[model samples]
Target: MPWTLPSRPSRRSLLAGAAGVAGAALLTGCSDDRPAGGESGIPLERRMREAAVRDSARLLERYDATAADHPALAARLAPLRAAVAAHSAALALPPAGSRSPSASPTGGTGAAAPSAGGEPVPPKPAEALTALADAERSLSEARTIDLAGAPGELARMLASVAACGAVHAYLLTSTPGATS
Candidate 1:
């Protein structure tokens, strides 16, 4: 008897594979010598990557502050905080000639957010959530504006992260179990 052919892969699997391939390419293929902007001899892409890391760190700080101040909400914010941590890891620029991504220069689990240091968290849980949502929205908008000038792979990554940030903003404020 003739053997049956293998079933076709689902659309979800295909897209996931494509994304993995694309991410690998970007990680291993970012080679450029041109300097778009450098006040202290840093390339624009490097600056952008650093900025992304810094912003994510700040967001993580906000998440941590909210969780610490409002232990009751910690469980709810944990997943979102983990996502931001992963974003922080992914946004880091690898050392020269390295292909894989690394964590930020701080090397602190969640302790080195420069700009977020000393910022007071709102006393009310709702207000704190609103602050987090505002931060996410602001960062998302900034990333969207930055997309026009970013090169190929960086632009794709930035767009994706920006979209994630927008989604985070919506999630932070939108009521749970609300009817349509």
Candidate 2:
């Protein structure tokens, strides 16, 4: 037979082989044995949950401080404050003993500290209410974003909390007594 050269591999064949190698690497590279929110790493879900919990605690603290500074507004703020407290409690991490290493400390869950020696004079009722409404609006917006990344149960809980915050914002801004 006359001398003949072997045909070279086509571009399509080369690409197919490359793809198969990449797929196999991906399949074997991931390890499911790592603990959830453990030393190896904190999953995205845990990070989002922790952030939500921290934000809820901060909101509760702010409400408490504002109420303390303006005792006259406490009655009007009670419902909103209670709502924030409920959200904080719901999102709070388990106790330190049972929590993972990646979990945030529970210190944020405590009562608001007095400002320095004594409480400063509070802002005007209208200003304070406006500030609270703004904060609630922000929190609600944040929760809405976090909901996208959360697990099914967490997403539902976050949706409920976001709705509560939005309602709280509306009520705070519109209530006749609060604007005074």
Give all TM-scores, in the order shown.
0.71, 0.62
Off by over 4 Å in 2: 1-40, 93-122, 177-180
RMSD score of candidate 2 (Å) = 13.2
Cα-based lDDT for every prediction: 0.76, 0.70
Candidate 1 lDDT over residue span 1-180, tens digit each: 999855998898999998997676555445563565446776667677778887888788888889999998898889988988787777675544654454444434546545625468899999998898999899898987766566567777788888998998998898877877
TM-score of 1: 0.71
Q: What lDDT does model 1 reach? A: 0.76
| Over 4 Å off, model 1 | 1-33, 93-111, 114-118
| Angstrom error at residue 3, model 1 | 68
Using lDDT as the measure, the top candidate is: 1
Per-structure clash totals for the candidates = 0, 0
User: Number of the top candidate by TM-score?
Assistant: 1
lDDT at 61, model 2: 66
Give the clashing residue pairs of candidate 2, or none: none
